[model samples]
Target: TILSSDAYQRSWKPNETNQQDERNFSRMVVRRLPAEVVADAITQATASNTRVTAMTSSPTDRTIGPDILAKNNKKLTSLNYTLSVFGKPDRTENCDCERSNAPTLLQAVFTRNDPSLISMINGSDRRAKGWIAEVQEWYSGKTKPTNQANGNKRLKQLNDQRKKLLAKAPKKPRNTRDAKATQRYQLTIKKHREAVQVLNRNISKLKGGRSNGNLVKRQITALETDKLINETFLRTVSRMPSANELNMARADINSNQDKIGGVKDLLWTLLNTKEFLVNH
Candidate 1:
């Protein structure tokens, strides 16, 4: 539905009644840029400043205006251009696509332990501790026990409540008074049934989370299972590289091996690339 709406807006034309349609359409997609994008932009700005300073000391830096910078550093220039164009706009237009929901901050905090995926910054421990405490408090306040025994007890209680409600319902709704009472009883019965279903689903999820091993061993098993599934899916869906592409990749690897100072530098470069940095 969102994609369809976006397509409609793209092809929509303005008439006298919809003279401000373009302005209204522009408000449809409000999304926060990815965290990796923000980080990359910061890095690029710092690098650009350093280059500008170094170049200013020489004679060639004076020629690099906005247009010249755009030609040489297209990615950086485009980023700047986009920011300039969309920095702040009118928000009066009512659009369905208001904002892009990103992963919660707590989810990001939990990701610090995965070194291969993300490297945690300094003071991450303090932040993670605060986030964990907040999450624990919230969970305690909101969630009930989802273990098997508790789930069964809750379901039984709900079923008893439903039966009691159903028994109170008028068998023959001959008048408006009987109909109203029967409707109320039916509503109460429906609520109890829904609660029972929710409890059953929660119990299933709790059992799935538990495993027959110590915490560390269970984690290792989960990681291995996840890796196997990912590899299998990639192999099934991804096409093999062409011979020319393979040769080019090998040549690029050899060049990097020769040029890079050490494994650390090579790994850093690989990890900082857009492909590796972005969360899929």
Candidate 2:
């Protein structure tokens, strides 16, 4: 009988590996909120009718409302739930503790049309959250139609696709691949535009230039030398060259030195010229 069993085991063993063979799905034990949240959750569950009482001693001990309370004394005194994780890890024994954590309580208080969950942003945020939680729990417990599962199934698929795409995208910089990609783009892109010849070559294109847009016509600079006629009129007079009109006399001399009486007389007459109007 032992030999037959050994023969049977030998017959079942395979020498080669097959890639297409399906492997058993890995069983995952997800981290879950601990009992404290469950208890706080109970408070959240029966918030309306639930009244918490405590014993306080001033002179004598007396039964008082829960020491910390919100609007209706429904508060908690230190609500973090310490816990240990459990899972069947690879190369380890099953249900080994994975981590230690303190579970925070998620809470909500609501009236009709109020936020289902009270969040840090809004008191109503929690209330709405609680309502959503209740709805999810109903479906999770199989108490309601499994519609939530279907919804969650689609959500999980989309989330997985997004995660996969993100994972596949390049993560490391300063790589040859990145350098090549940048070089390729730089080579393909046009750095300077080609000169365009659009108008007819023979006919000068008419520019519909608005006078305002025409930038003051490259401002034709006039030669700063005085008008010949103005210089001649000044040289005709004999007057003393006043310091203010000294520049004017020089301008006259430069323009008509050749036609003047004599260089000395011209200088004398220029010095006496009345064009030098003296200040009172």
The C-alpha lDDT values of all candidates are 0.38, 0.30
Tens digits of per-residue lDDT for model 2, 1-280: 8777754445333334432333521222223333333334323332221121211223221211222333333332222221111111232535535432332222111211112212211212211232223322332443333554454555555556545644554333355578877675554432211111222211122221112222231211122122222332343332233555556544554555342222222333322232321111
Write down the TM-score for model 1: 0.18
| Model 1 ranges with Cα > 4 A deviation | 1-219, 222-280
At residue 154, candidate 1 shows an lDDT of 55
- Residues 84-189 of candidate 1 have per-residue lDDT tens digits of 2222222355762433334444324333333312221111211122222222233333323346457556556656665665566444345657877779767776
TM-score of each: 0.18, 0.14
Top of the candidates by TM-score: 1
Any residue pairs clashing in model 1, and if so which? none
RMSD of 1: 22.3
The 10-residue segment with the lowest total lDDT in model 2: 80-89
Candidate 2 to truth, TM? 0.14
Stretches off by above 4 angstroms in model 2 are 1-141, 172-180, 183-280
